[model samples]
Every structure is written in C-alpha cells, then in structure tokens.
Target: MTRITVLGGTGYAGRNIVRVAAERGHTVTAYSRNEPASPVEGVEYRTGDVQDPEVIRAAVTGTDVVVSAVSPRGELEGTGKLRGIERRVAEEAARAGVRFGVVGGAGSLFVSEGGPRVADTPEFPDAIKPEAAELAAVLEDLQSSAAELDWFYVSPAGGFGEWAPGEATGTYRTGGDVLLVDESGESQISGADFADAVVSEIEHSEHRRERFTVAY
Candidate 1:
C-alpha cells in the first residue's frame, strides 16, 4: 500500500481524497491547520501551517506520494506564501525521490479558441479569482522548475467543489486541458468521483508530469 501525505486534508476536496485513499487501504497522513471534525478512520492527522517546509518534509518522509490539496484563500496577499510552500514540497519530494500530485484549479484550463480561462470568464465568481491565480502560478512554476519531479496537476471538472456538487455515478470522464462536458453540456463531477480520479492516478502513472481534468 502506498503511504500518502495529504496537505490541506481538512478541506472539502482534500477530505474527500483522504477518505477515498484511506478506504482504498493506502496509509494516509492528513496534514492541516486543524484536525478534521470527523476524521476519517485509518488516517493519521497532523496539524501545521502549509507554508512550513520543515513540517511538510517531516510529514512527507517515507511517504510514497505527496498530494497537495492546500487552498490559498484569496485574502492572503501575494503568491509568495503559496508558491513557497509548493516549491518546497516539490523540492523535498524530488530529494526524497517521491511522486507529487497537486489539486489544481480550472482557471488555467482553456475554454475555447482565444477565449479567457474559466477563472477569467464572467460567470466565474470573483471571490475565487485570487486563489485560482495563485494556483495557476504555482503550476507554471512547477512546470518550469529544475527538479526532475514527477508531478501531476489534477484540475477538477468545470463547476467543481462545494458550490457544484454533482451526483456520484461511480463513473466519470478524464481529459487533458480541454474541458469535458456531459451530453447535457454540463461539466461536473461529485466530490467522491473526483477523489476516485485522484486515487486512480495514484495507482496508475497516467498524466505524469502533466495536468488532467475530470468531468461527468
């Protein structure tokens, strides 16, 4: 079984991933600012700030994979904190020769020819823009970094997260940068299904060193 450390394990997406990973019999260490209110069984919970590399490194030690689900709230100024944290995690994962996976935003995903990113679209909420931009920047940096890190940036389907909770059908579609939509022209997936995609990636090496998205 793979030993996985999930940063931001208490958040919505992170918690789902942790639960699914644990259920799959993978050992999980859930690192967050606070313990989960209802911690998943079989998960080892640890409390710490996401920006601390030493803490992250300690948590990552001996782990087979590092899944960064850390969310950068928009109120936080600049991308320094988020970038620093991701860079450090990538660096440490490289040093430890471990695989890395990131929960990236759909902001960087293209919608159409010459159209703006999902985050830049008028339909996208303004409240999430800052965090989306920060995530995009971090992905860009990770792509350009010198470290030979085998990192996968997993972007959710459009209308993802708590705001758009699609029903879990135990089946979903995966795509690269292009958006995936159902026959109804809707792009979404349940939290559990998204977690399923992440765990599938963990088990299989598809989308290595690149980004992929999930949808109904």
Candidate 2:
C-alpha cells in the first residue's frame, strides 16, 4: 500500500481525499492546523502548521505522495502566506524524496477562446478570488520546478464543491487545463467522484509533472 501524507487534511477537498485514500487501504497521515472533530478510521490526524518546513517534512516522512489541499483565504497577506506554505511543502517534499500533488483552483483552468479564466467569469463569486489566485500561484510554481521533483496540480471543474454536488456515476472526464463540461453543458462532479479521480492519479500516475481537471 502507498503511504500518503495529506497537507491541510481537514478541509473540504482534503477530507474527501483522506477518506477515499483510507478506504482504498492506503496509509494516510493527515496534517492540518487543527484535528478533525470526527476523525475517520484508518487515517492518522496530526495537527501542525503547513508553513513550517520542518513540521511538514516530519509529517511527510515515509510517505510516497503528498497531497496539498490547503485553501488560503483573504487578500495580499493571505496570498503571501499561501505562497510560503507551498514553497515549504515543495522544498520539504523534495528533501524527503516524495512526490507532491496539489488540489488546485479552477481559476487557472481555461474557458472559451480568448476568454477569461473560470474565476474571472461573472458566475464566479468575488469572495473566492483571493484564494483562487493563491492556488494559481502555487500551480505556477509547481509547473516551473525541476523535473526530479514530481508534482501534479489537479483542478476541478467550474461547479465544484458542496453547492454543486453532481451525482457520482463512478466515472468522470479528465482534461488538462481546459474546463471539462458534460453533454448537458454543466461542469461539475460530486466530492466522492473527485476523490475517486484523485486516488486514481495517486495509484496510476497518468498525469505527471502537469495540471489536470475533472468533470462529469
């Protein structure tokens, strides 16, 4: 079984990844600022700050993959904080010889021809812009990193998250950067289905050294 460390493991996306990974029998260690109110069985929960490189390194020790699911909120300060955290995670993962994967924002995903990002669309909420920008910066850093450090940034479709929980058919479409929309013209997937795709990537290594998006 693959040993995995999930940074920001208590967040919406992180919890799903942790749950799915544990259900699949992979040893999962969840690193977050606070422990989960109800921790899932078969997953180890550790409380620590992601900004600390040494702490992050300790959490990732003996793990094959590190999934970053942290969402940094607010304005410029928040963006700087997230950048620091991402850099620390990448540096520590490289030092520990572990593969890194990130749950990136849909803001970086391409829309129509010569159009704006999904986050830039009118439908995208203004409140989440800062967090999306932070994720985009982290993705850019990962993409420009050296080849020896294997990293993948996975971005979900436009209508991701709790509000738009699409039915899980145990299947979804995957694409690189471009947004994936179903035949009905909806771009969304359930948390479970997104988790399924994340776990699949962890096991199969299909999209490596790049970013990918999922939808149903």
Index of the highest-TM-score prediction: 1
Any runs in candidate 2 off by more than 4 Å, and if so which?
74-77
The per-model lDDT (C-alpha) reads: 0.86, 0.85
Compose the digit string of candidate 1's lDDT tens values, residues 131-166.
Answer: 889988988887887657989999998778887766
Q: What clash pairs does model 1 have?
A: none
- For model 2, residues 45-65, the per-residue Cα lDDT tens digits are 999876676787787688999
RMSD of every candidate to native, in Å, equals: 1.7, 1.9
